[model samples]
Target: MLENPAPPPRTSPATLDPSAAGAGVPCRAHPERTRIGNRPARRRRAARIGVPTDSPELNWLRQSLRACDLLASVHSISPSDRALVAFAIEWAPYGGADTEDLFIKFGAQRNRFLHLLQAAMIPRPSDLGHLRNLKTTLCNDLLRAWNDTPPHNEKQCRRL
Candidate 1:
């Protein structure tokens, strides 16, 4: 007989004993295997291709986004929204990303992308002032450009 017997291996869902699994609750033997740990893994996978953040001038926002350890903001935001945030950060120094760029990158026209970006930022925590300021500035610039451009037959955005 083995001095220390190993735990029985789980063969199938039907054979899983509830009592063995901590009485129908999750087996907390390994904290890393819990929901909290699993959710971050999903986020990491979703954003595995982190934002491409190279630009002429290095800014705090860009540096934060490009950090080796992913930021909490990155974890909290959705993948699509992360794209918008990245686009905003990259273009902030140059006023903003234009409608054609937005459409090309996001597949949405200026007005539509503006609305989408606004919605995306709502759920984000406001404590991150840098992010909030970046978004606000970008949104303002986009709105201004949207208003300045003539409604019909608009080709290029009017820059102030």
Candidate 2:
């Protein structure tokens, strides 16, 4: 006759009720393992600025911002902050500023130009005079930049 095997080891009360023993409850799906005590990890904080993925400047800015953590400073203003605000404005959509054949063409280029005009990076007073001055200066600068370049010909249009 075959010998009877030793009886399987019995579970103690403490082992069965892990919570009562201060080990916490076992996971419902995984009864053999004790529940984790610590809180779950948090998601990483994201940058407030939004920029297009295709922009090389945006990639460089993100890397630089991550390395420095410039946002940590309370009062100091950094170049990264300026760039962030600029790009955020650049990517934002603008309503009809001009019409083509009674239709408005809204695209990245038009938005960028609108952003350069409307972004609040420049300092100003509450008075209307200051605002007007700021607008004039910005418009003049834009005119100068655009006028510096010669007009594109049919060949340039074809190449584009």
**Largest TM-score belongs to which candidate?**
1
Q: Tens digit of lDDT per residue, candidate 2, span 1-160?
A: 9986999899888868757775554557644433322212211112223434546544543443332232213222245444433343333223223334112333335435434433433333432553345333433333233334432441221121
RMSD of 1: 13.1
What is the lDDT, from 0 to 100, of the residue 48 in candidate 1? 72
Per-candidate Cα RMSD to the true structure, in Å, reads 13.1, 19.1
lDDT of 1 by residue, 1-160 (tens): 6575887776976457655555556556755676335645555664677733343344454353453123334554567777775676566556567878987899987667767755654434633655555444444444444455423422112121
My TM-score estimates for the predictions, one after another, are 0.38, 0.19
Off by over 4 Å in 1: 1-57, 60-74, 124-160
Clashing pairs in 1: none
The residue ranges of model 2 lying beyond 4 angstroms of the native Cα positions read: 1-107, 110-112, 115-125, 147-160
